[model samples]
Target: MTWTLKLVNRQPMKEKLGLLVQHALKSGVAAGHLRPTEIPLSIALETPRIAAHGDYSTNVAMTMAATQKRAPREVARIIIDHIDDSGHLLSKTEVAGPGFINFFITQEKWYEVLKTIHDEYEAYGACQIGLGKRVQIEFVSANPTGPLHVGHGRCAAVGDTLAAILEAAGYQVEKEYYVNDSGRQIHTLGRSVFLRCRQILGDAIEFPADFYQGDYIEDLARLLVDREGAHLPDMDEEEAVGICARFAAEEILSGIRKDLEAFGVSFDRWFSEQALYDSEAVRSVIQDLKSRDIIYEHEGALWFRTQDFGDEKDRVVVRANGQTTYFASDIAYHKDKFERKFDRIIDIWGADHHGYIPRVSASIQAMGYDEKQCRIILVQLVNLLRGGSPVAMSTRAGEFVTLRQVVDEVGRDAARFLFLLRHYDSPLDFDLELAKKESNENPVYYVQYVHARISNIIKKAEERGYKHMCWHDDFTDLIKLPEEIQLIKLMARYPEVVAQSALLMEPHRIPFYLKELAAAFHAYYHDRNKHMVVSDDAGLSAARLFLVSAIRIIISTGLTLMGVSAPETM
Candidate 1:
């Protein structure tokens, strides 16, 4: 299976620097200072923490000293001396710490980053690492038995942002929601709604101990009575339960769809678990496993030899009573995904499913597919807090806050922003009070304020009789202040940050990067001695406007990726 490559349209500054460093290393070998055969397979360049150290730092010499049979400092000197600076990309190269070669990019060259952002606009951070490979991300596959709670909201935010990130990195991405409408959960939903319906028909029936107790069940009951009241009363209990189940499942799924859509999540597919059973895909998978000697009858129940493929134990695919396990449907679902020819399949499951990972991986291997073709992302629980008190939630008893309620309370922007503010695998403490605040302490407001502040500056510039023009004007040398240089450097790092986030499958890094960029812009704006955006010198004013425009572009691009908005005004 060959995938066409869609390389980045704009060459990143880091890649260009890496190429320069590689060229210098080869030059050193050609000049006889280092052995050509001893060249390392890969070279790494990193940004130094202290601004005084340099813009970029590499420790290749230190790692290669033993291979080249020379002192680390001598190797560093050889590489630095042979480095070509004719392009004037580097201001100077110096040896720092034992053998670290630090390259300081020319201050004027950093301004070119602004031009790249202006040219690419919304595509400033987009790259092409995935290169048109088909990848399907299945996330927020909550069963249609209830409303999506705050935890599911986090999963939705993470999954949606990850899809956007992968698309930006040039993957042919499809987002999907797996509907678990075939299982025991659906039966429970139906039974719960049916009991409520009997009550609506004036029956004094007591609710079961294990029945769903959500108010939404009452809504589904009312809906079912409205649609099938006359027919339901005439039917037997078993037949009515089936009708109630189907109606309740569809209604709950509709509500789930609306909640996700309101929270800015959309899926390319909504796969039905019952469809697998209806089409006999589940039976076929079991038969295939049996034929491959991967399945055996143990105590009258059919079992898959998952223990042989790294699972802790063999798992039952079907019980003796002829009921299929959820595991069976999951195996068929994954098999169906691979049959669709996606090069990569990602399943975002809740953290409680952590133990289920090895078995699923085993299932893929058992089905004659590479385990590496599938990746499982586990999203941890969200601890909803109000002030300092923990919010109580029990989904079975329906005492939890719905995701829609959170979005309505704090607005969609804040809800989504806070959800991704922390790593998905780590437990997130969502403070209801803070998320709704307009102060700088709120992360969403802090980052968004930078964007709004930049907009105000642009508006102020236009009011001063200087209309903002296209960013093709040269202002590279005009941006000389240290704060201006810092902001440009941060903006230049946006593409690399996005690429790293996509490669690592960590969208949380984006919010952290945005915070840093926002802080840099705030510092630059508050520098007392100069009016950075509006000035007497038209050249400097244009230059400052260009800087603000680049900042706005990067912030908006990142916010869009997180499904959060970048407002023009506060």
Candidate 2:
């Protein structure tokens, strides 16, 4: 069947109206009246956070007035006159509050949205803005020197969730981790492990203050002794450190993958810094830069004139010590990512690495690519709280708790949910005891309880013979409840939620949206006994049953994206 025919059977009214507004606004611009380079069509349909204003409101007229040379009210009136929303979804459009167009969709349209919830459940909350293009998302590329801490945990969750959101919106997305094995830090890691190996061999080696002090280092020492021998025959510290670093990296990376797996974070690939060097991509990229005249030598060190491309300062591509800088390897790595045919590449880095953003973009643009094609999502630090006191996490003292330790103490569900509780850019304060609490006071438990309650509702429906009743339009009277309409309206907005999360690179929005949806289910459940599903009417019960099932599916879909559980029974 043709797409137009297919859409006629299924597309939601909100999507159609959004398209009309976009087309109409651009048509207004083409008619020699307005211009829209500064603002987009989306700002014109943003709903006020305070629900009393309207269903959705926008300030398109205000945005276009500078080009129209007319008042925003006049622009809004002209646009409204051109709009043909025969459906009551556009019940009224008025210019209000400083050139804003406020639109109130009708109650009947909101009620009709229930049919959309069920009709599109399999492909329910999806968008096609990506146009089937492949995107690569690299995140939590921490050094494999030790276990990941709570701070790294945030990036892992954010990156993985963003990938899920993009995939849901029909993008072919790949999740990757950049392994920093070929760096000076790995040499330092080797030295730290070898010290532990010496201690295991009964040698009185003085531990350096900067050495890794985690118990895992001692475990690596034991592994080396068990696999090799008790006595070292005149081996230099450098050779021993090399062995230790190699062994430590393998063990630590294995443990890192296991920890992320337990947290439901999986990657499609683990790209290596060493691999770039081995493939000679690094040398090829450096040669390409030299051909472009962006590379130069000053005081025996090679530099890239990144300042010319918008970086704050020139960056060293190679230090005077004959070793290339990490920044250079990064440029090569990003070039490889782009050359692999991904339309977009997203890098999720820790907030501490915020300074690296400008140089990376400058390098990308200097290599003849648009700076906008590269995106870096910087996640703020995660403050760990246990019993209300801040848990001191010092890597120098080896006092940092591993991601696995956090998961063991609390759980995968609690850790995953809490990591995604805030905006991706906002600093997350993760409380351990609060996460483990089984009471309704725990936010994770509170959200999961709603899912469980709805599961119970489904069982009650079956016990009341709803299992045999065919779900059709005739039994939609129960969905006519005010609360039922509210729930449907929330579900109807899921596609937009997914789209926003992907475009803004904020996957935490998914968890927040899930919480709001679960809140609706909880409020409805709290009123279940009093609200009376029976209502002395069969149609009411059927309609309520349909709405409850719809909510359960949406909640499950959202929680799954975050790797959190949707328990059938609390």
Candidate 3:
């Protein structure tokens, strides 16, 4: 049998089943077997947990039953009867519990996915769900006063992976890091370094309790002394502190850049908070709000009417002392984002910033944009552990584990994969020992091992003189084992997984799907007698080789989305 490769990407198996269900509903209406009401614009199809249920299940019948004023199973029976399987898409259909229509798809239909993976290769799981809309994801915008911590690492992984998933779903994506390089924090950093510099020059000084106490402050002071030859303490104190603040901020920001680069995250822009003030954007926004009466002076401070736009209460944008609040700069920053014309604005902030979302979203609305356009993802903190015991960390004391240190301890792949194993909103307990493990207990190793195992199998097959076949070759009946069919079904769900993960704006779904796929493949591989890939039967070996190669492609693609590598060797 000759196979024809279609130029267009094939619809996912779930989508195909949805279309078939829609066709059956229309056919039942046309035949007068069911009452004509409204059909759902989009039907929902789900996979059954138990293997015996069916390949795909849908409750469209039950949804229609309420409108049809008929028993659910009766409607299900009518719909299933009218289902047009002329394309040989389904082997059988059954009305299961409570009117769910379970569809058992044909083996030939399932086999088509292997060929689809072959035809599309790396692009197999990609879809055009995003439709080229512009999206800006701002994450890990940690204050430049200190190095990034474990929590910042989680934010980086989630934001970067979400951006990659959106890109795969066809969104025009840009990643941004907002730099908080101004305000009191920077001044505090300057004072900390200046005090350290004075102590370095043999002047005994008592370090203030409020000052930053990390050894990094001393490092910065020593660097300043090396550059200026211990004359900083002799200069005017205020002028010297000003110089120290600028120097320390730049040095810390540079370290943040190196750490993120090592963690494999790059941003399209680094927006400056000070630039907002310097360019008068902050003043301009406040003036605009005043002109529109959105800002009113109550206690000698300018307050934005956030309550008008769904906030709990009005907030002060400019304090009574005439200095703009951090909220003022936030308003200006988000207004700048809207002015950039991004269709969607995503902010990945720590869960502690949960209360800040309402006011910022209100600012977006006050700027004459839809508040819904700005999406805020709050990531919970990471509790660092060493062999299940809590790892001590104190940010003010500068004794916390930095992102650089974590990446150094556990490789980037392990750090990233473990960071994404759960949803962003859920707190993660990151164990150093577990991440360093190379065995099956470690998730990254488990997933990466599947790719390596498949590579070794393909190499062994090539050495045994098995030529890889083209997509046009017919291999339907050759891969008939239960495990092989299950693998094909799992592989077929990848495109849907990518699309859904993008739709929900959750990057954890990709890792979850990959872990499931890896477990299934491992089970099949370990059962060597029944599931050998390179058997003496040339036709069977060739077909199994084709299936395993497709699996490898999916694993590699999933890992790439997570910013992890798919090594050919463990």
- Steric clashes per prediction: 0, 0, 0
**Candidate 3: stretches off by over 4 Å:** 1-9, 30-36, 472-474
Question: Which window of 10 residues has the lowest lDDT sum in candidate 1?
Answer: 1-10
RMSD of 1: 3.1
Report the C-alpha lDDT of model 2 over 1-570, residue by residue, as the tens digit. Answer: 677755643555567667667766766666645554554646446757876667777777887888767898998877776666755467777778778777777776665566656767746787788889999999999889988998888888888888888998889999999998887878888888787877777789788877777888898888887887765324876888888888899889988999899878999999999999999998889888988889888899989989998888899998899889899899999888889988898988999999998899888898888778788888999889988999988887778878888999999888988898889788888888898999866778877787888788778777777664336666554456667767777887887888888878788788788888878777877775755554446677776767777887788888888888899987
Error of 2 at 492 (Å): 1.6
**Higher-scoring candidate on lDDT, 2 or 3:** 3
Strongest candidate by lDDT: 3
lDDT per residue, candidate 3, 355-411, as tens digits?
998899888888889888899999999999999999999887789999999999999
Among all windows of ten consecutive residues in candidate 3, which has the lowest summed lDDT? Answer: 1-10
TM-score of 3: 0.96
| Runs of candidate 1 exceeding 4 Å displacement | 1-9, 37-42, 471-474
Each model's TM-score, in the order given? 0.96, 0.91, 0.96
Computed on alpha carbons, the lDDT of every model, listed in order, comes to: 0.88, 0.80, 0.92
Candidate 2: which stretches are off by over 4 Å?
1-6, 20-43, 48-53, 65-75, 91-100, 231-233, 291-293, 468-470, 534-537
